[model samples]
Each structure stands twice: as C-alpha cells, then as structure tokens.
Target: MPALASHRKPRSRTRTNSPAVGLTTAAIASVSLLSAQSATADPKPSIDEVQKKVDDLYRQAGSATQEYNRAKESTAKQRRTVDRILDDVAKRTDSLNESRRALGSYAAAQYRTGAVTPTAALLFADSPQAYFEQSQLMDRLTEQQRSTITEFEAEQAAAAKQRAQATKSLESLTASQQSLRTSKQTVQTKLAEARELLSQLTAEEKARLAELERKREEEARRKAEARAKAEAEAEAERQRQEREQQEQSGSGTGAGSDTGSGTGTGTGTAGGAYAAKAEKVLSFARAQIGKPYVWGATGPSSFDCSGLTQAAWKAAGVDLPRTTWDQVKAGQSVATADLLPGDLVFFYDDISHVGIYIGDGKMIHAPKPGANVREESIYYMPIYGSIRPA
Candidate 1:
C-alpha cells in the first residue's frame, strides 16, 4: 500500500511540471514577436531615393563612355598618322639607297681612273650644305649630279624626321589605347553596380519606379511643348515688328528676322531654304528614331549619342569627328537662341553627349544603353553648347 502511494505522488508531480512547461513556451513566443517588431522598425530608402541613385549611376556610365570615345578617336588618328609617316619613310629610304648606289659607282670609276672625282670629294665633305660652300667639287660636278646629291640629302633628312614622328605617334597611340581600356572598365563597373542595385528590388517596386519615370518624362514633355510654343510666338512677334519697322523706314531689307518656317514636327524636312542642308540632317536623324543605343557603335542600326549626331551630319555631306569632344568643334558655334535644325547640341558640363536639333526645342539622340534613339526636350539635360554642322 505504501509503494502504491509513492507512484501516485510521482504522477501528481508530472501534472504540475506540464503547466510550468506551457508557461515557458508562451514566454518564448512573446520574445520572438518582440524581435520581429524590432526588425520592422528599421528605416529603408524611399523608392524615389533609389531611382535617383540608379539615374546617377547611369549618368556616370555615360561620362565614362565619352572618355572611351575620346580615347578611341585619339588612337585612330595617331594610327593613321603613324601609317602615313611609315609610308613616307619607306619611299624616302628607297630614294636614299638609290642615291648612295649612284654615288658608290661614281667613286669606283674615279678609283679606277687614278683621279678622285668631285662626287667622291663631295662625299668626304663635312656636310652637304658645307660641301657646296667649301669644296671645288661643286664647280667640277655636272648640275645633274649636284642636284642628285642635294635631293638625296633632303630625302634623308625628311626620312629621319618622319621616323621620329612615327615613334612619337606610336607612343601617343599606346597611351590612348590604355586610356580607352581604363574608360571601358570604369563604365562596366558603374553599370554592374547599377544592375546589382536594380536586381534587389521586388517586381512591384520596379513597376512603381517605372511609373515614376513615366510621370517625370511626361512632365518634361509638357514643359518642352510649352517652351516651344512660347519660342514660336516670340519669333513671330519679332518678325512682325521687324516688317513693320522696315515699312516705316521705307526699307524693303529683311534683316534680323527668324527665317525658319513653322517650328515643324521634328520629323519633317521643311524648315527653309537656308536650312536645306540642316533639313537633310534632321531627316536622317528622324529615320533612326527607334534604333538601339550602343557604346562605341556608329552604324545604320545602332549608335551612341555622338555617333548618332556624327552619322546624321555625314548623311547631310558634312563630316563630323567621331567623339563628342571633337565633334563639338566641327562647326560654327551658335547661341541657344540661334539653334537651328542641323545644330549639334551638346549636353552635360563635360560635353559627353550630343544630339541633332530637330526644331521645336527638341533634339534626337541615342540617349543611353537599354534605351532607343528618340527625340527629347533639349532641356532634358543641361546644355553645354551648340554648333551648326552644315
């Protein structure tokens, strides 16, 4: 009977322990809830902030791409120069060899005759110019022989100068090549970081961000339209005032008047007679409306910013440099008020981007990678300058 009582006491203690274990589990659940709340309290950047960062990354990449383009242009120019110098050197070398052979034969003839010829005496002179001044050889040699000597000396000197230029150009080319590589790597790095940042967002976040971009673009388009309208009206008013003034002065002269026909839709080639070449350039740009943007590509299918402008001007029979830095100097500088359909508009403080003005305060350009060639407001970015390519 005592053993039975001991076993029942153990069962009673087990029931008491079960209640304590349940309370302990409840405490653990409360702690987990508190931890989750704490984590949710931390702040994250807003979508607008993220969008700005991504935009900045893209701008940085664009800047680096321009650097690459500049380096590529430099390298190409240097290579051409080096090739020209090498060709010139080869031709001069052949002429020098021929002259030396002729002189050698003349020396052999004099040796056989037991009388040194003036050609041989001229050879031992301090310098070709000095030989003429000091040697009796000048009086003895035929004019033809003297001319050959003079021509050979000149050719030899030119060859030496060309060789030196080739070496210098080659060195410059190497440096430009290195700079190109560095710029390429920099662009890649910036793009990679931007991609990584974009990858972190959820689909919904991306959609929202895209919506924001759309709204911003819409706003920009509205502003551009307003500006274009204002400019057209202001131009018309000025033209009217000028015509009235000319009538009052009894002068039929039509100076200082805006001659560009209606600020037409960016697609038409109908500006005016003076803008005939510019119209052709704008037509070519309009035809490339939906092509993809590619770095360092200048083609019928794809192009970078400067590449697009260069190609457009080339179509109009005006050859422009391949990079924005050089292309900026390809034509007459124009003020913002004087921008015409064929003007090349530069962007950014560094002038890394270029677009062809297509009237109505709009410009057509290859905006960037992952974007298509299209027309946008000239005010979309800060203007550096404008040049009329035709």
Candidate 2:
C-alpha cells in the first residue's frame, strides 16, 4: 500500500499562494537587495570630510552643552524654589498643629467645666463652623475661644494650600531635573561621536586635518585683520572730518567751540571708561589661556564658551548670565564691524557659543571639548552678533 501511494502522483497536490509565504519571500528578496546596495555603497569619507564631520559634531556638542547649562541653571533655581516652598509649608504645618493644640485645650477645659458634653466639645474642636451653627453652643463659647477656632481654620486652609503648592513645585523640579539629565546625555553622546571619529584617523590624516584647520584659521585671521584695519581707518577719517568741521566753525565764530569741546570730552571720557574695563576683561581672559575647555564650568581652571566669557566679564565687574542665549541679551547689541575689545562675540544662529573680544578682530574663548582656552579670529565661526556687556 505504501508503494502504491508513493507512485500515485502524490494525490495531485495543489499549490496555494499563502499570504505568509508570499510575505516571507518578499522580505527575503528585499533584504538581499539591501545587502547588494550596501555592498556597493560609498567608500570611506576623505580626510576633509572627516574633519568637517568632526567639526560639525563638536558644534552639535557645543549646542548640547549650552542646553545642559540652561537646564542646570533652571534645575538649580527650581530646587531653590522647592526648598523655600518646603520651608514655608513646614512653618504653616507647625502653625496648624499649634492651632489644633489650642482647640484641644479649649475642648478639654469645656469638658472639665461641664459647660458642654465631651462629644459636643469634640465637635467644636473638629468643625468650628458646624459647632457655631448651633446657637446654644455658639452663645456659650467665649470670644477668645471663637478667635482660636477662626485662627485654627485659617491655619488649616493655609497649610493645605501650601502643601498643594509644594507638590506642584516638586513636580516641576522633577521635570527640570529630567531635562538636565537628558541634555547632559546629549552633550556626552555628541562629544563621544566626535572623539570616535577623530580616533579612527591615522597620524598622517590627523596631521593633515590639523594643517587644514590652521590654514582655515589663518585665512580667517587675515580677513579679520583687514576688517579691523579698515574700521580703524574709517574711524580716523570720521574723527578727522569732525576736527576739520570744528576748526572751520571756530575760524568763522568761536560761539560753538565750548559745545564741541564738551561733546568731544564726553565721548573721550566714555571711551576711556569702556577701554579700561575692556583691558581688565581681556587681561583676565588672557590669564586663562591654555585652560581646558570644560562644559558648564565657570572657573579659574576650566570653562565652556559662555563660561569663559562670563568669568572674564565678571572680572571686569560686569555680571553676565550663565548661558550664551541670555548673555547675548545681557547688553546692547552691536554690529560685527563695531565689535571692540570686551564685546561679547556670539556665534551661530542660536548663539550657543561666546567669546570675549580682545580687539584686532581676535577673541579669547574656551573653544570646545578636547581643546583649550585660546585666542582665535572672530571670523573663526559665523558671527551672529556682538554685545557690549559694560
């Protein structure tokens, strides 16, 4: 019987196109195609491309570091608020307990005097309004007793409200803490990516990258120097024109001499004050050269972009904000051409990086991870704008 069945054409087996089988076949084909495409994918990036990618990663990390700084500041402020709220809540709670104790003593006195039943005294202590609704009990209570009950109710209400506020503030603090953690992670991840990319390069490739960077920086420096020179010449021309006008006016009539002299003196005095502060700011920044670039750090040892600027300005007796975004808004905005020593030079559209301008188109800054605080041309990065913090 087995031999007969084997030879019977396998019962004219039917071929059905099952959906799962079809899907599996299609998926296999798709994977094969993807594999083939990947095999023919682009070759390794060139050194220039690698440099660009690493630079972009560093820029991304800088932005994330700023976010971390902002989140950290917010978290600290929120924590302070929470602590203050908790203290207020604690005091309110203590006051509430004190009022409850007063009510209890009043209830015990009433109970002992036989003026009211124990149950009624308990009700008077628990629910002052309800107990007062009873005219007999209300009439029997002394003014002092009524005052104590009112104060107890007020304290209880205040305590409840404060507890609610504390709860809300705690929730906000938790959220800010989470944001801080996320931002920190983002910065770390970006920096790790940049470091990994750099690690993959050979010594020759690394040297080439460094050379490229140096050339780029040098070109930027040249352009910045030219710009500074041009601005200086224009200023000189403007001053010359003003002097000539003063001389001509004086020659015609000495009437406007005092006013012109006063204006020039006032301008000179203001310029002198700014230059003095700027010298201090630049001196402080120069002293910090070669320090490591540490994100979120505002110290003598290390610093981030904004941190260095903030610390430098602080040395000049100017209080700057912690993050670049805020620091960008801390003072009057100035054109890049008008940037002078001590101006806060913000970079990138989001203003995530900052530096202390030290004149001659150079700025002292804590550049980025794996780098040290140094002076570079303002044109090293795209300038968003400038701020005169003083």
Best by TM-score: 2
Cα lDDT for residue 262, model 1?
45
Q: Write the per-residue lDDT of candidate 2 for residues 62-143, one digit (tens) a residue.
A: 8898889989998999999999999998888888777767766665665565666654555544466565545346667789
Candidate 1 deviates by what RMSD?
9.5
Looking at model 2, residue 160 earns an lDDT score of 85
Clashing pairs in 1: none
Report the error of model 1 at residue 164, Å: 1.8
What's the true lDDT of residue 298 in model 1? 88
Compared with the true structure, the alpha-carbon lDDT of candidate 1 equals: 0.79
1-390 per-residue lDDT for model 1 (tens digits):
554545444543335558779899999999999999989886666789889988888878888988988888888888898898888888888888898777655445434553666566657766565655564445666777778778878887888888898899889989999999999999999889889888889999999999998888887778778778877777677677767888888875755444446453321233454377777788899999999999888878999898888888788787888888888887788887766677888987778788888777788999988899999988887889998665
Clashes of each: 0, 0
Clashing pairs in 2: none
- Candidate-wise lDDT, in order: 0.79, 0.80
TM-score, one value per model: 0.71, 0.81
Best by lDDT: 2
